[model samples]
Target: MELTVTPAALDCFRQEWAFGDGEHIRVFVRYITEGDPPFAFGITRDTPSDAALTTVAGSLTFFMERKDVWFLQGNRLTIDCLGEDIVFQLL
Candidate 1:
């Protein structure tokens, strides 16, 4: 439950996904391990997915694929498959 992403990165995401009352933008992350640089890669597609969006305590969660679910906050995101190994801090 750690956070990665710089202020700039957060800004980029905010600007990129400025949803105006339609559907909440969902952030989906997956586990992609590479040699010497094992990390959880990010897949940000503008189009919506089959994943359902549920709001809890002001946090929008995508509970479709638990194996690769990305607990997101604003532009800040954290994936757990890597045991908090990979960080995508906006930078």
Candidate 2:
């Protein structure tokens, strides 16, 4: 698995979330049966309990816990901004 945060996303995190140096950002998967995709990606400010993968962009660190790694195996996950909202893409 790989993770990438676009420049726009990094800026959005800094400006909107007010994230500072060494802050941890968690990437997670949640099931929502009502949604088209069934499963959705979520981002939050959190510390790692059992990080399976981690990457740093700018001053912030983004990570996915061991339990969530199965959702993203062999994929590149990208985080970006669409207008004012955060979007996730797998490539």
Candidate 3:
């Protein structure tokens, strides 16, 4: 599985990544909504966990759930901060 973090996304992450000490951005998949895209993404601060698969791009670090790896494979996505929403564009 692979993910692409664009320059715009990286800048946004840098601005919002204010977790203290050892905490970092954790990207997780949630099945909360039943819409066109069945899965929802979440980004939050968390300490490194044994189950998380780690990936780093530029200055940003991402922790993804092992189970979510299959879905993310071959998907190139861009994260853009539009007001209060973090929009993911599939490229």
Candidate 4:
């Protein structure tokens, strides 16, 4: 439900999404579910938000306010700025 983002990840996010727009990030998440009828889930930002982030899973979509956006390795993560230690909880 939570992950600590790395510094390297933060930089990449800055380049790809934050390079031109000071207002938003062109980010999304993908999820794969195993079942007889396998399913794939993806959540792309529909509205520009400097304060909110969300993703889709199963029958629900989770959302929280974004405090900071950072990247790690080959991935990106947004932190709950309202929390301590850049906590990101996906629920």
Ranking by TM-score: 2, 3, 1, 4
Poorest 10 consecutive residues by lDDT, candidate 4: 81-90
List, residue by residue over 49-89, the lDDT tens digit for candidate 3.
55436666675566766666555666755567675456766
Per-residue lDDT for 62 in model 4? Answer: 36
Q: Please give each candidate's TM-score.
A: 0.33, 0.92, 0.65, 0.27
lDDT of 2 by residue, 1-91 (tens): 8989999999999998798999999999999798687888898999999999899999899999999978886899999998878899998
Cα lDDT of candidate 3 equals: 0.63
lDDT of 4 by residue, 31-79 (tens): 3457643432222334445535454322223343353222223343443
Clashes of 2: 0
Q: Which 10 successive residues of model 1 have the least lDDT summed?
A: 55-64
Q: Pick the candidate with the highest TM-score.
A: 2
* Backbone clash count, each prediction separately: 5, 0, 0, 4
Alpha carbon lDDT at 75, candidate 4: 42
In candidate 2 the C-alpha lDDT for residue 27 amounts to: 96
lDDT of 1: 0.38
- Runs off by more than 4 Å, candidate 2: 34-36
Instruction: Give one digit per residue, the lDDT tens place, for model 1 in 13-73.
Output: 3445442333343445554567544544554434345554333212222222333434443
All candidates' lDDT scores? 0.38, 0.92, 0.63, 0.36
